[model samples]
Target chain A: MKASYTRLAAVLLMALASVALAADNDNHQVTVTVNDINELAVTGGDITLIISSATAGQNPNQATDNTCGLEWTVNTTNKKITVATNQSSFAHTLKVQAASVSGGTAAAEVTISDTAQDLVTGVATTLGTCTLNYRATATAAQGTQSVAHTITFTITAAS
Target chain B: MKRILPTLAATAAIFLSSLGQAADVAILNGDVSLTITTAAAGQQPPAVTDETGQLEWTTLVTDAVKKIIAQTNLAGPSYTLSVRAVNISAGDGTGAGAVVLSTTPADLVVDIPSGIQPLDPGTCTLRYAASATVTGGAGTDNHSVTFTITDQ
Candidate 1:
């Protein structure tokens, strides 16, 4: 009877050890998630495209060097920068052209309308500076009423 | 003596049966953990100085995988998971240093809870894409994402 009891105790101890080992093997997995980021910045807000007193002979009143200028610095992380005007038509025709860019290429003289325009289109990952120039065409009817238009800039991922 | 021996054998059998019951009663509590991952690694969008310049971060559901893994030992109880932004730094531009984080399937509220079945404890996983946008000053913007889990 004593020998039988010793065998039973050993079996119970082994069972308990196995259960503890199994519990130790169980794991609860966790994962941390963050997504890709692409950010952009532009210096100088509310650009004043001042086209001084115009003469009809001038046709298109071009802005002086410091008169109508804006600079944009963007980190286009594998994306392109698109430009557009808020409305299809304004009191006066507004034209925007990139004078120079620190990196990549810029659009030639493009008239702003409802449609979107491409300012910078490439996969560049550095802060790029782009110089912009604005021009306006005023008619005798549409005098110096000080018309204002909102220009929108958009960034899109590369295909 | 012979009758006493039979009684001893019967007592031992009863003790062994009790041990078996104790083993069957072993229970493990369920738990869950969540993590946010990105494919772009360390690259972050440039800081904005004005509204015209916008910063955008996008990820496919497969790439971001807002992962949530949960396990349970008992049936009938469900686990709820939710996430949100904790802090945002300052910026001069409009909506600058602001974080607009959103999940696809638009789970603005609590998501579907992980359900456990009878006689079986199991684990469940959920994945989704996250997108964020901010516009503001040219500085290091700070923010955090919070994840919470509850049982119901």
Candidate 2:
């Protein structure tokens, strides 16, 4: 009985010593999650406007003519474009138009109300094509000069 | 009896010393991240990796498709980013109006060579390819690709 008791004491002492000498366990975690990405791309890197010389009465005027058509594409929930000009004074009446949309979903279209509108009228994931047209008055500056206008396109998450 | 006790104590001391000799295991914690710095409808210019590296296209465009280049700052004995497994994890589905990415020309299997032992962080660049079939609707869309980075 005494020997059995000694063995039990030895076992308990070893257990306690093992616990004391054991290395502390350290733990850490790394979580990786991917977020939804929204992106926009245009075919042509930059846009160019070509204004040709016309007769005093046959200029590319807003009433009956439009020119400098550009094609752009979007791939986002929604897109809007705003037009501005560097010409402080109005020697010639300049008009900008979102010509039309093609190659997109049925809901895709162009909005041109002299303000910002969807690149493709509605929100969609389809790759649509849009034509941007600019019209200038016939009775403009006499000399062959150039004026700069800015066309800014914006992408949004809204439909 | 006294001799037996001393022997048992010696055995216990030996076992505890062995535990003390064991090395502590450790691991670096954080996220390994990759970002496409420049890409277009059918083009992937280059990508920046937060893992101390950058990625670029091996070939600018092959048959109207752009390649992807991946680089990282991970000091490696060896590094690898899987090719066949590289794919779009989220975004517009890869269906009719979806943009698909691959490591091959036929939109099939592409064998991108892994980085050998790179001395510097951004020295190695792994290339991948991309293709897109855009239909009607137009808007910006986000896409993601998950690739494993192995340093051995």
Candidate 3:
């Protein structure tokens, strides 16, 4: 009877051990890869700026348009937006300024030329927007000539 | 002596039965991968999701209910990652909704009925979603997600 009792106790201990080991767990890996994203878009349709009239004895009135805006989404750091024109020389001057900026500092009004000029500065990882204020100025000595300029905007690493 | 022999046989049978009914859990699917590479201008990055992973579990504990919990190894990630159980098999377990993944264990599936004979396993599909904002920048987060079956 004593041997039987001892065997029963051992069996009960083994059963308890199995119960303790019952809880199970498993694992799997999850890899998330995020790529650098920089997206820029131009809102509104094509705009036409015309300098048609001026006050007496003054240069032709400047034609200004704020109907268009620039929007960008950047996920990296130390970036800025630059603007350039395809025309190297023209009779009239075209200037652009970034106003009502949301995510970056607006540079001074830039005279559009072949060389790229900074339009927005201190743009880092953020979503930003600004109104593209365009102004066209002509003098009486330069005469009246319609100049169609193709402007390009680029986002690049800040200097 | 005859009564002692019968008692030992009954005890041995009971122990063997308990040993055969141990709870177990396993992942049926392999590692999951997700990516976030696009977003609209002037907006945050869109969330991405993957639903190819699955989980299978078994339990026979009659006294207590069982649940499946999930946890990750990454802490202080720049982006947000969330998970949920979906397309659950017709069993005793119910799918839990989306839960943001973190180091602390959170319930992914709950109300698992126990005492299942023949060790019928409950299974469910796993869905993982990852998202980021423009300010969060870009990076990768590798997480070793663990799933455990424990008494509730």
Candidate 4:
């Protein structure tokens, strides 16, 4: 009887130790990754610039529109925005300048063509906004004809 | 001799049963990682999700109801992280909806019925979602997510 009591005590002690080691909680690692994000958009929709009348002796008064704006969100450093138009040849010359620029340096007014031109430079990791000023010029010699331009803005790595 | 043998056998059975009643829980799968890489222009980064992690638990306490709560170690994260329990099996437990994880403990699974025997573990799938915005910028948040099973 005494031996049985000893064995029982030993078993109970072992079981209690096992219970003490049992874990009621567990954990795992979770990594939330945010990759480099560069997002650009054109807001305020389509704009129209009509050159109705021109001052005497000079080219048609340049028609300008500042209704549209460009907004961008870049999470990477050393990025720039480029602008280009679809039409290689057009009747009127179109120029674009980034005005009231934030988070980047506005480039000089660029005469838009088929080749992409830098619209904004020195853009780092930040949210930026700029007003797009478009100017259209036409000489009286060029006949009056409607020309539609499909402009594209892109955010690319700075060279 | 017969009487002594029966007494030892009964004692052994009780000890084994007591050992099996201990509370335990574990994450069966490995850690979960989610990456966000795409978003519309001028919009917040799209939410990313991962469903590869799972939770397994065993509790034999028959006197009270049990539940699972979750928490994260990240205190001030620029982004948002949420988790939910789904596809529960082998137990009577209701999964909670998506709970945005933080330093505070939140209910992840509730109403876990007790009397779950050993070798018959309860399991549930873990779904995690992470989101960020352009204003949040780009960074990585390593969260040590903990799941605890306790009596409700």
Error of 3 at A67 (Å): 1.4
Best by TM-score: 3
lDDT of 1 at A86: 75
Q: Taking the tens digit of each residue's C-alpha lDDT, what string does model 1 give over A26-139? A: 322222222333444544556666667656565546553323333333333456666788776567777776656654467677777878777766636444556667666766
Write down the RMSD of candidate 4 (Cα, Å). 4.9
Best by DockQ: 3
Prediction RMSDs, each to the true structure:
16.9, 15.0, 4.5, 4.9
Candidate 3 docks with a DockQ of 0.47
> On TM-score, who's better, 2 or 4?
4
Q: For candidate 2, write residues A1-159 as lDDT tens digits.
A: 578557757765775675454332222221122222233443344444445655576755334233333333343345433344444543445555555555332223332233555443453444345455545553544444455545455445444
Residue A84 accuracy (lDDT) in model 4: 96
- Compose the digit string of candidate 4's lDDT tens values, residues B1-152: 74876577677757665665656778977888999997776556779999999988777766377889999999998789999999988455888889999999999998888766557778889999999876677789999999998887
Candidate 4 Cα errors over 4 Å, as ranges? A1-22, A43-52, A66-68, A85-92, A99-108, A113-118, A121-131, A140-150, A157-159, B1-20, B88-91, B118-120
Q: How are the candidates ranked when ordered by TM-score, highest leading?
A: 3, 4, 1, 2
lDDT of 3 by residue, A37-134 (tens): 98888887688998899999888899999999999999999999999998888999899999999989999999989999999999989899999999
Q: TM-score: which is higher, 2 or 3?
A: 3
Ten residues in sequence with the least summed lDDT for candidate 4 chain B? B13-22
- Which model, 1 or 3, shows the larger TM-score? 3
Model 2 scores what on Cα lDDT? 0.35
Worst 10 residues of 3 chain A by lDDT: A14-23
Per candidate, chain B TM-score? 0.21, 0.25, 0.82, 0.83
